[model samples]
Target chain A: LAKTTQPISMDSYEGQEVNITCSHNNIATNDYITWYQQFPSQGPRFIIQGYKTKVTNEVASLFIPADRKSSTLSLPRVSLSDTAVYYCLVGDVSNTGKLIFGQGTTLQVKP
Target chain B: DAGVTQSPTHLIKTRGQHVTLRCSPISGHKSVSWYQQVLGQGPQFIFQYYEKEERGRGNFPDRFSARQFPNYSSELNVNALLLGDSALYLCASSLIRVDNSPLHFGNGTRLTVT
Candidate 1:
């Protein structure tokens, strides 16, 4: 499994775009990049997943470089509600499908 | 459709004691995985069960174990718990036991070991 490193915390103002980058230098061949969001006390929610290049959804967008060494989760026009911890995970495909998590990036969107 | 659901919203246990947490996955989900989340940290994978068989286990000790029923409901059991065992136990369900499937998580059972 590839270990991921992200910013410990980040601050942003409302209506601004936020891009959080995650680095996984040793990503495996079958690893897929996925991002999840978690609030104060709820379970982590799936935001986006991409194998390569870019994947855009209604909530966010994920961009992966050709080397797959790093990825960015971009949230457009973020609001206060976007204040939460965002996790970037390298997909585990060893038949276990067990998820590995890192400290994650705490994004605080303020007004 | 309902998302994953876990029972015993909150629990408090003593050292050397044991605890069991239950989870009901979405109506048609067939794979269930368990995770432990400490305060201010991300969720750590514990175990994964699919079609009533154990598929994966994490770096946790022998005290941590889990199983999935034929119907896809799952149970996480911790024996001889320690203070460090106090954390949120989460259950995630996915439609299949494949790597590409995104996991749907439950609110989780909060366990406090005193």
Candidate 2:
């Protein structure tokens, strides 16, 4: 499993774009980067995933550099409800069942 | 379609006691995984079951065991628990058929050891 490094916490105002970067220096060639959002007392929710380049979805966008050692999760026009802890995980498709989580970046969206 | 469901949203147990947690996956899903989340920390994988067989396990002790039913439902059992065993236990379901399919998690059963 590739270890991930992210910010401890971040504060942002509402309607502003928030970007969280996660670094996995040991990412393998077969590994894919995935992001999940978790609120207090709730299970983590899948946000976005990408192998390389950029992948956009309804909720967030994931940008993976050519090296695949780092990825960024970009949330556009954030709201107060978007405040939560976001986790970045790197694992292979066949072995994702045994994912290892990091400390995660706590995004605090203030009004 | 119902998502993953776990029984007993909260539980209080004493040291040296045993506890059982149950989880029912979404319809047509066949893989279930267990994770333990301590306060202020990320979840740690405990076990994974696929098609009623144990697929993988984490670095937990033998006191923690799990089994999957033929219907794909799963149960996690912990014996001779200690105070440090208190944490939120989460059950997630996913299909191996889908590449990079994200896990669907339950609200989790909070276990408080007294």
Candidate 3:
């Protein structure tokens, strides 16, 4: 499991883009970076995932550089409802669900 | 399709007591995993089961055990509960073939140890 470090919290206004970066200096070769979002009193929801370069989905985009030691989750045009905790996880799925979640970055999207 | 579902949305137990939390995986999902989420903290992996077999486990004590049923449902058992055990218990399910697939989670059971 690759221990991930990320900002404790971030603040942004509605309609702004928010990017949360995670650092995994000890990422393994097979490790994949994934992000999740959670609202108060709810379970975390999958946001995006990537191995290297960049990957985008309807919800968010993941950017991983060539080094693969770090990844960034970009939420475009955020809204107040998007305020939630974002978690960055780096692990090998081949290890059979050894997901270790970090403390996560609490994004506060202001109206 | 119905997503993952957990029973007893909320529960209360005293120290040293035992509790069983249940979860029903989504239709066609063959794997179920349990996580413990303390207030103001991220969730910690507890256990993962697939094909009615233990596939993985976290650092939780032996007091915490789980098993997947024949129908792909799961039960998380906690014995000798402690105050620190009070937290939101989340159940996530996914197909075991592709581990990178997103995990579908239930609303979770809020367990309060008094």
Point out where model 2 deviates above 4 Å: none
Per-residue lDDT of B4-106 in model 1, one digit per residue for the tens?
9999999999999999999999998888999999999999999989899998889999999888888889999999999999999999988774558788899
Candidate 2 is graded, for docking, as medium
- Angstrom error of the Cα, residue A89, model 2: value is 0.3
* B2-114: candidate 3 lDDT, tens digit per residue: 88889999999999999999999999988899999999999899999999998999999999999988999999999999999999999998887785776778989999999
Interface root-mean-square deviation (Å) of every model: 1.9, 1.5, 1.6
lDDT string for model 2 (A1-111, tens) is 899999999999999999999999999887889998999989898898889999999988999999988999999999999999999999963554889998999999999
CA-lDDT, candidates in order: 0.92, 0.92, 0.91
**TM-scores for every candidate against the unseen true structure:** 0.97, 0.98, 0.97
List the candidate numbers ranked by TM-score, top first: 2, 3, 1
lDDT of 3: 0.91
| Chain A accuracy of model 2 expressed as TM-score | 0.97
Stretch of 10 with least lDDT, candidate 3 chain B: B95-104
Model 3 residue pairs with clashes? none
Which candidate do you rate higher for lDDT, 1 or 3? Answer: 1
Kindly report, for each predicted structure in the order presented, the TM-score of its chain A compared with the true chain A. 0.96, 0.97, 0.96
Q: Against the true structure, whose DockQ is highest?
A: 2
